[model samples]
Structure formats: structure tokens, C-alpha cells
Target: MSPALTAEIAQRFAAIALGHVRREYPNKPGHVLAGPEDARTPRELHPIFYGSFDWHSCVHGYWMLAHLLQRFPQIEAAPAIRALFDAQLTPDNVEGECAYLAAPEARGFERPYGWGWLLKLSAELSLHTHHAWFDTLQPLADALVARFEDFLPIATYPVRVGTHFNTAFALRLAADYAEATGNGALFSLLCETALRWYGTDENCPAWGEPSGDDFLSSALVEAECMRRLMPQDDFLGWFDRFLPQIEAGQPETLFSPARVSDRSDGKIAHLDGLNLSRAWCWRALGKAIPEDDPRRSMMVAAAEAHLAAALPHVAGDYMGEHWLASFATLALEA
Candidate 1:
């Protein structure tokens, strides 16, 4: 097992975050150009989230910083973290970000992925009680919430991929926000959608896995989403049927960590994330089961194995460095 999170690790992770959160180039801007004027720098396009490789990665990177700062308020990074929030989360900046979203050409801008993380960031900041970050960021976050309210009704089928398109991964984060903030309407919609999409899934084919750009496990993320949306008893029963072979580890792919041959190539780097996220799912799944369940051992072992595979590689390349820590933090916390 890994060591508990400490102030030192928290500061180091915060430093990694600060190093990239504002370094605006080598960027992957995921936007639609409505006119020639739209082709500006990342900062001009997104004043708050113009760093950390891409918009979603940057969004979650900020989430990581805020999460760590809140957890370890005495860490050296806390002051800088607060200052960054003060600077970037201004009403003008947030309104600018929202204006981009209101653009008619940008309906599917970040879709469920970035949209979910934006809410997660909002939820994280809300924990900072008297702080201005949450209220300042709420408008942008609400814009995404509105997008979700609009998007989920028409999104009858969940996107089952292992990347940004995966609807389950998005829903899991969105569920966190809905629950934390007591958004009854969104939470109900999420639960209903999750049950409708995955309640009947059984014997998921875990093989043919690890697509080149897969940072998610389609099977496991779906299980995670269901776990969030359903009651513990209902989730356990559904999980048993969904991955019926877990006790024996029959669908071995789910138990094995992915191998990353090239961390420098952005797409290949996703294998590292595949490993970390699998660990997150496994650890979470393990906790949801009983002390004596045979599958719990399998799940724990799988989580550790995946953690071991990916922990050392969380750095060393820009492609992976931009966002791998968020997943690593998720797995480590699990």
C-alpha cells in the first residue's frame, strides 16, 4: 500500500500545478472558431483555464490545487493558491469564460468531460467557506450545469469510450457536484439517466481494451457511475452482475495495469492514465463491497498493481504531466 498523503507531497503536487497552470503555450485549445477573431491565444480565449495543456486538463488541474490547498491549508502553496484564485476567478474573467460558452457555435465545446470538471472545481471551491472563489466561479460553473441540464435529456445513450467522450466518467464527477451542492434536479436527472443506461448491463467484455488514447476503463467507469447513483445494496447487486467474473478475475484485462511504451507521445501517454484510473475504480469498488467478499481482495490487489505501474510515471513528460496527477491523486486518495 502507498503512504498517506502528507504536507510535503501536497506542496510538491501544488508546485507541479503552479508550474503549468499559467504557461499558456504548447496548448491544445478545444474550441470551435466562429470567426477569424476567435483565433486568439489560449489566455484570450479562456482567461481562467488557459494553461496545463488543454482546457479540461487545466480545469481539473485547478481542481487539484484547490483540493490540496483546502485539505492542507498550512502548506506553503496555500497562499499562492489563494492568490491565483483571486486573480483568475474575478467576475470579469468568469463572465468572459461564460460568454464563450454562450456562443452559438460552442454548444458541444467541452461536452460532458470539461463540463463535469468545471462543476467539480466549483464544488471544491465551495468547501472554502468564506472564500470568494466559489461564488466568483459559480457563474461559469452554472453555465456548464445549464449545459448538462440541456445535454443529458437528449443524450439517451451513454458514450462508452475510454476517453473524454466517456459519459460515465463525466457523470461520476457531475454527480459529486450535484450531491455536494444539493442540486436536487440535476442529481435526480443523473440518477435516472445512470439507471436507464447501465442498470441492465451484464458480463461486460473487458477484453479488447486499452485503446491508444484511453484514459478511462469503459467497464469500470460505468460501474463507478452506477455506484455513485445507486444505493449501496443496489449498487453491490448491480456490480456483481455487471462484472460477474471479478471474483475469479476472468476478464483479466480489468485486473491488469496497462503498459505505456511511450510517454512522450500524447496519445500513448494515456495508458499511464488508464492504469491510474483503473486503480481509482478498483479501490473505490473494493470499498463498496463487504469485508468478507472474495472479490474485495481481487479489487484491492488490482488497485495496488495499477497504482504501482502508474505512480512513478506521473511526471517525466509534458504530455502526461499536464493531467496525470489528478488521476494519480484520485487513485492515491482511494
Candidate 2:
């Protein structure tokens, strides 16, 4: 059987997130300072997401915790997760975050990457209807939705990089929020944007994959985005054209796992994330293939290979530990 998300693994992931979600000092701020007065601490800039090394990582860290809590409430970390949410996911804290976003210098702050993660976090919290976390976070989510609506129309081209700037990664992650919250406008916009950007793509070379600092696979992520947003039949047709050689494994790069040379270096640590996220994309896209298709088994094997290469390294180094569990949760759950 494929490695599934067991309660044991969920507990381990939750514990990892709890360990760093609030550790603010070792932060790498994605801030733009317009003046000396703009010089402020990360905690002051992002009250709810000042931990896990950076803002985007911290946002997705909370997402992993929320997802794990919902999936395995009986895990040892459940109570602590609940307590952390109760303490930090408050309206005041969310207001501070929104205010930071509204600043002129912060217009492009976090852009599609952090924007997508914040929405993903909101989507997970929305599942916990018994709590008011989602309600408190709705304003921020709405702000991001507006950002997407405003930005997607003007974004003439898709960012095909295998990194945070990748448009496909953001759209893939944000689709969950649009569907869960019944935001029809956002959903339509996302679908339209994806189709506009990736609809014509055919025979992707995938030559630049596993870029040294990449944490995502541009080719697979775009495929996953279409899988999430398009009708099944339409997505299948698009997939056939976009990656027509999957059955033959012609784009050999997508079938292979990336090697992480150094876990201690933050940029190089991204390879671990690249592996985990490729596993996520493969496992998810695998479900779209027919059972009788040869690509189905290939996808599963590829996912397992990527997971094996990276899962063991999810913890040891602070560089990866601060964020990799979220991607692991995504893969295991998929």
C-alpha cells in the first residue's frame, strides 16, 4: 500500500509545527521598508504569522496543524493545537495582518505565494465549524480573494518557475479556499486564469526541473492546478496534450526525485520541499488517470520514490523542519 497519513505521522507533523509556529526571532521577513519608521520586527509586522522562519512558511505551518487536527483529533498534539489557535487566531491579530497588507509598501508583499497559503489556512480552519477561527479569519481571506480578483485579470502570463513565484502553485493551493467557502467569483476567476495561462501548453520539455533552489515542480503543479479547477474530461484532454509522453515517461525529469545536497543551507533545503511537493502533485494527479492506464502505476511509484527521498529529512535540520511537514501532509493525504 502507498504510505498513508496515519495518526502517528499526523502527531509527528503536528508536534513539529507546534515547535516552531511561534518562534519569531529566527525569521526572514519578506518586507519592503519605505522609511526608517517601517523598520519593525516580524512579530509586529505579522502577528499571526511571525514564526516558522518566514511568513509564507508560518502560514502553511498553521495549515498543516489545522489539517492534522481535523484528521486526527485524538493525537497528542490536538489540545496544544487548539490552544495555539485560541491564543493567536484572534480578530485583533488578523486585523494587524490585514493592516500590514493594506500598506502602500506592502502591495506586492507575499503576492501569489503567501496569498495562496493564507487562503489555504482559512480553508482548513473553515472545516472546524465548531470554532470561530474561520470567522475571525474571513476578513483577511476576503482581502486576499479581492487581491486575486484584481491581479489575475492583469497577469498576462503565468509564472512557470519551480519556486514560490510560480503562479500554478498559488492557484492550486488557493482553489481549496474557493471551493470550501463557496466563493463562486473567486472560483471562476481562478479557473479562467488557469485556462488562459496554461490552456495552450503542449509537450512540456521539463528541462529545467529540480532547479537548485526550487521547492515545486512547475510542470506537475500546472497539471495539478488544471486537475483541481477544470472538469475531469477537460482536464484529462489538457493533460494528454500538455504531457503526452507521461505513459512513455519521456519527460524523465518529472519521474525522478530531486536530491538535496545540503539540508542546513536554507536555499538548498528547498530540494527536500521540491521532492515532497512533487509527491503531492503525483499522488493527486494519479487519481485522475484511469485504473487500467499504465501511467497510474507510474505516478504511484514516482510519488513513493519522491516521498522516500525526502520524508526522513523532514525533521533533522531547522532549514527544512520549519516548513516541510506541510508539503508532507499534502502528499500523504493525497
Candidate 3:
């Protein structure tokens, strides 16, 4: 990385750290703590203003924090981030129990929505930060394993669905955490479960059938997890086959656009925008792309163009600051 790029990454990381501390968390869970100076007040956050917090929003925040920490390891913030996540451990914090949330929180609501959210959160936190603060995750893993038979057959709405991306997230998390914990059996179990979803055969045909924006996200996540766990040769082949489509600037059938209801705003389709879906591909491919491939440069150029366009629209110093800055860092890293 060039000196200029290095400096930019550092600034962006600091901004993310500061913004979360100052704004987003101030009136939420970590309000009592010393956060960033520019923290968003309770009035400014719409959901919180309405007296409710989206479970996935909290999950996303944890994921972003993990991403930033992986880039810039800070011992000081580890505990706080860990604690913020800890707040949602109860069942009340889970999914439907927002109405039942009270006093000491319960292990996130036991429903499919909450369990899926927690499963993803725990896996990412452990995988990214390598922090053991949530020692409870071990037993939680055991419980999930015991209950796997119940959650299988990934269902649609009202059928206890385990989301595509979220399930993919769980697979990666479980694999990473299993390795970290030296639990070979658990690792294998997680891998097998994930494979059941993405494997090429009839067992995982559902996972392979690309159908929606959510499915595509899940597929990309599956691809990433496969990249991490599968042999390098297989991963390379996967990349070689699909990357050409990306390079050609054509959408692949692997990802379903139907689930992306928000894309009509044209926020995601435009190359000059920070589309998360496109960034997901860039992130995985950026690390895997061969140095000799001209497509690598094309990917970087596309990401840069998006960054150039999105820079002006980046929300306040803390709201969407980390999301934008981290990608900028990723683009520079590319």
C-alpha cells in the first residue's frame, strides 16, 4: 500500500471508531460509556425514536465493528464492543419479543429470527475479533447443533426460515470459531451443515439455485466460505469461471435481483454507487484475483468510481461513516 493510501485507511478507521463511539451508540446500548464526540442523539435515530431497534441493524453494527477491528486491532475497544453485543444476548432481544423485552435481557429470543441473528453475530464476532469474551457461544453452539434437525430445510416466510446470507454467515462463523476453539468435530459439523446448503449435489441444490437478492448474497457468502474452507484449486476454479462475468460487466444468474426491492432507487445498479452486493463480490474477488489478470485492475477501477461518487453522500461522521470508510479502505487495498 502507498503511504497516502495507508494514511487514508488509518483516518477512515479512526473515523469509524470515533463515530460509533460518539454518535450511533450514544442513545442506544452504550450511551453511558465515553463514545465519540459526534454521537447521534436519540432524536435523530428514526427507529430508536419510535422506541424500537431492528435486530439486524444491531447485528450489522457488530459486523462492521468486527471488520474495522480486523483491519486495526485495538485491545481497548475489544471489551466495549463485546459488551455492546452482550446486551442482545437475551431472548427478549432475539426477534419477536421486543414486546416482552424487560429488565435483565434473556438470551436473544429463541425464535428462528433471533436465533439466526445471534448465530451470525456470535460466529462473526469470534471469527473476526478472535475474542473469547462470549464464552457462552460454546454452549450456544452445542444447543444449535442439538437443534439443527429442527431448523433444517430452510423455510420461507412463517416457516422458520434461516436466511441465505445469514446462514452463510453462520457457516463461516462456525468454521472460523471451530478452528479457533480446536473443536475439530464441531468444525466438521459446521462445514458439513454449510455444505448441505451449498453442495453441488441434490443435497444442496436449494442453496445452489440462485433466485433472489437475498439468495445471491447468500450465494456470495457461500462462495466466500467455500473459498476459506475448500482447497485453493477449487476456489480458484470457481473464481475463474464467474469472475469473467464480473469483468464483462454483466450480471450473473447466480444472484437473484428480485429480492432487492430497494434497488429501484437506482442506488445499487449504478457503478458510481456503493452497492453492497457489488462490494461483496469485489471484496472476495479482490483478495483472490491474480496479479496478472487485467480484471483485477478493472475491479479496482470500478470500486474507485463508486467511491468517488459516494464520498459526497456519505452520511454524518458516525451513522454510515464506517460503512463507507471501510469500503474505501477495501478499494484502496484492492
Provide the overall lDDT of each model, using Cα atoms, as 2-decimal numbers.
Answer: 0.89, 0.93, 0.44
Poorly placed runs, candidate 1 (over 4 Å): none
Best-fitting candidate, scored by lDDT? 2
Per-model C-alpha RMSD: 1.0, 0.8, 9.5
Report the alpha-carbon TM-score of model 1 versus the true structure. 0.98
TM-score of 3: 0.53
Q: How many pairs in model 1 have backbone atoms within 3 A of each other, for residues 3 or more apart or on separate chains, i.e. clashes?
A: 0
Per-model TM-score, in order, reads 0.98, 0.99, 0.53
The Cα RMSD of model 1 versus the native structure comes to 1.0
Candidate 3 lDDT, 121-201, residue by residue in tens: 455556553455345344554555444434444422122122423555445545654565576776676556655555552
How badly does each model clash, as a count of residue pairs? 0, 0, 16
lDDT of 3: 0.44
